[model samples]
Target chain A: MSKLNIKNLIKSFPSMDRPAVNNVNLDIESGELVAFLGPSGCGKTTILKMITGLFQPDSGDIILDEQSLLKIPTEKRGVVMVFQNYLLFPYMNVNENVGFALKMKGVDKNIIDQKVKEMLELVKLPDIGLRKPKQLSGGQQQRVALARALISNPRILLLDEPLSNLDAHLRDEMRDLIVTIQQKLKVTTIFVTHDQEEAVLLADKIALIFDGELQNFTSPKNYYEKPKNIKAAKFFGGVNFINAKKHNDNLSTNIGTIHYKGENYTDLNEDNIITIRPENIKLSKNNDFNNNSFKGLIKSVIFSGTHTRYKIIVNDLELECSLQSVGLQDIKTDDTIYVHLPSDKIWAMNE
Target chain B: MGGERLKIILSLTPPLLIIFTLFFGGIFYGFLQSLGYQPAIGKYEINFSAYYNVMFSERYAKLFWTGLGLNLWVSFASTFLAAVFALFGALAIRKTFFAKTICNFIYSLNLPMPHLVVAVGIIFVFSQSGLLARFASQIGLIGSPGDFPVLVKDKYGLGIILAYIWKEAAFFFIILMSVLQSLGENFEELAQSLGANRWQRFRYVILPLVMPNLFSASIIVFAFSFGAYEVPALLGVIYPQMLPVMAFEFFLNPDLNARSEGMALSIIIAIIVMILVVFYFWLTQAKIRKD
Candidate 1:
């Protein structure tokens, strides 16, 4: 059985015209780290809050271990959330902040002290327990907040944009710490983040939401290659979308007939739109001797440090292709190249 | 930077001059008088006789000690009770939008009201022959109009304390409401997620967060209540009056020598309040360091 199951969750505020969270459902297995991925105001945090009982769902059932948690109060729900701003109590030192949950539970002072030391060590922030929160750096404060949340051994750990407040380098360090501690403890975790890269890097599975609706929930690789809709694909940086018609084993678009061999196109209607990742498109000088090949002119080239992005105009369609910077010295603007969209790499969705 | 400093100094000169001349200057003059420098009476020699008389003299010693006790009682009780009431009031209405708006309007209504008006209002409502006393007599709760309890003009300074609490709780409320509203529910929610119950959240999070502001505001209320003269003069009894009222009584004496005693008493009140403030800061700082 799943460790946490959210069934038909719905919530709305009177000030909003639409529901803040629509009928959203998810099932997270024990010891699996999931990311609620969405843009701001997309109801990802709302679902996290609903699970923690901070914001009660207008209607739904949140089940943990086959028991409904709808009626449980926030403090009794056995769930802890680390906020985006690292809401460590300013008045308390790191020791008191980290050991606060245990103290509230009436644990002995000696045990709480021992556990706080251990938790701090887990976050690689030991010996700073005597310092107040304001005295520490941002990364230190976030680590302390993480240690504070983990001290209680909660059933579920929720992190709401935990890395949003950190700089680029610190975010990577904190991400590694979160993953290491999560895997070591094998605790069920759910984090809310709008950064697609962060979601892909940290989450075992990503639950993509758009406008308060659950758009797709799948693995990170699947979200890149096989999004449920165009919005999900666009959110993951999918810019090459071909509006086409699927006829048996091939797709017909404004450019020409394109041959694809994917079972996903079978259930798709005749009128559809096909999407392919930029990295999946092959750009070669020689004409490939296969299906799904087209002659195109390179319109523009943006050479980023890691990869070189190219805008290729193939007939009436402008397809974006990214090639690694290793051996791309030969490709430049106005070069006629052969673009090949691999048969298996193409995913078609109903328009 | 030099230009900015010049601008700041130029702008601040007006207020600085006013404060130095009117406030500190007045205190200096009063201190000189308290030390027996009454030039109006050709008494140029300065000494501590006024202070000694106020403190250890046989004639005024009993009145001085009892009046100091009453002043301390009224100030401490009113400041503490008003703070407690205002804190709970702020916390209760912080999350309710409609109630917060209405309660804020009603709570702040007492802020601009003159303390003298409030004292008179207390007298009208709580005095023996006041409106409440007459209402109680009509309802047969008491035997007659004269049978009502002596709530006002009593030895404990209940009427004076009531008036101060009623006026000062609004000041405390405004400060607390702004702090609580600006803080929002973030800290409380964080505490709640840590498995802390409601009371624990308040004790550990809310109370500590608001303690500094509450303490500072209480000091203001305490100092004002201890030194203000009108409320106690209107509501206090003939004997064992508050320090401020007793000092005023000495000033009202026809003898010009009595003026020095009144100044001495005022200076003593100021010194005591300053010492208490410093002690309070030391205590809170020590507690914070320990934490």
Candidate 2:
């Protein structure tokens, strides 16, 4: 069965101009990890809250597995959410917190004990049963939160930026923990995060939203490669947006003229915006192919350990280009070099 | 020392000094003067006999224990009733405009109201020849105010309780509403989403969440009622005075020994209040552990 179907869901707080989740429509399948990627106050969490039955939509319908979720009260909706702050009930220890759902369900204590142990093992925190939430580290508390939600064998898992509070290293570790546990559980999980890297790393499908509106929803790979508009393109790490004007068999941009490599280039368009990922532009002298290249003076270069990012000022358009040290050609500031932006890497978004 | 430490210490000292000077100092002064060794009483020696006589005198002992028992009962009953009603008042007023306005008015209404004046008002409303009696007579339930069973000055302390709840429940509502508001809206929503009904959410989530505030508020309310004089005096002053009223009688007695006995009774009140504080602290710690 299709796990979730939301039809034109709309919710608004009082005194607001419009609904927060305005006419949101989507379908979520079983056993798929979807990420709601958006900026702060974008109503991603609101949609998640509605899906989890924390909020009743002002209008419209939500169907879960062909059942109208509208009539069902929250607790019986078979959805568990992990909050952004981890929100492990501070008064409860690891085991008690994790077993709260089972307790609510009135499962036998002995069965709850066994299942809690199993869930703990799955989260790799089996030894932390008696420790309170404050005693554990952020990652540990996050695991406890995950374990708590998973103990009930929920039909779907809703996560609202569950790793937002962790530090850099802990964030990375917990990101992997979420993906691993989500896969093993095989439940329809919606992971929410504002960090594009985290979303890309963990999401099987990403729903990019902006200002309470869904921009594009697709797999992370497809989203990054084929953004539907300029907003989606900028949301990701792709920085170079060159206005391309179609000229016969080629397109003209700020970095100079470029030949269209894809088929059906004859369909001329003036409003097309060419987007290039910062890392896609190659800087070298090997003369790889008969593709397009920008010959410009390197204005600045920032060397991060694995890659050197260059800001090349060409024809008043500053293009960000990140190249690995292995592909280095001893380029410095004021050096005239050819930065190759492959036709495959140059994405033209129709906005 | 760090600049932050200096700033924090400076900011916190005013409250600490105020509490120590007023409450702690006032209580210590009261205890010392109650021992019958005060030079103002012309008693230079610390006399155990005065304490012994104060504790064992037939008339004084009867009044002391009876008032003590009644005080404890009134404090507990009002504390419980106030807490229960305050929870309703707190929960009833969500972010709604009407509820907010009503809650605010109910809570702060007593701020400008004199407790003695409220006691008089309570007596005027609930006593015989009071509004209830008048209304009852109009409805043909009672023939006369004299036949109204005399709730005021009847020695049962029922009117005292009525006065206590009316005044104290409002204060409890103010503290409780603030606590409930501070605990956030997400928790109840989250608990409900996890399958808890309203009562379940209240019992498991909201109560535990606001228990610390509830406990402290109850203790303060209990202490206030136990020590209250004006309400009891206005309601039942002549029949059988409360401990504070009885203490006032001893303090103003013509005999010197009765005054010393009053001092000793004050000591006993101090001891009872201390015990109440100790128990409150113990229960609070236990609740924290349970949480």
Q: Name the top lDDT candidate.
A: 1
Cand. 2 Cα-lDDT: 0.80
Error of 1 at B143 (Å): 4.4
Candidate 2, residue A302: how far the Cα is off, in Å: 4.0
DockQ score of candidate 1? Answer: 0.70
Q: Which ten residues in a row have the lowest lDDT in candidate 2 chain B?
A: B46-55
Show the colliding residue pairs in model 1: none
lDDT of 1 by residue, B18-127 (tens): 99999999999999999989999999989999999998999989999999999999999999999998999888887867566788888878999999999999989998
Task: Provide the DockQ value for model 2.
Answer: 0.43
- Tell me the spans in candidate 2 whose CA falls farther than 4 Å from its real position: A245-258, A261-270, A283-288, A291-299, A312-318, A332-339, B1-57, B94-102, B132-151, B237-240, B283-291
> How would you encode candidate 2's per-residue C-alpha lDDT over B79-136 as one tens digit per residue?
8887887788778775668467866886668756778887888888888889998888
Each candidate's clash count: 0, 1
Candidate 2 lDDT score at position A29: 88
Query: TM-score of B chain for each model?
Result: 0.90, 0.83
- Per-model CA lDDT versus the true structure: 0.91, 0.80
Which parts of model 1 are misplaced by more than 4 Å? B1-21, B134-147, B281-291
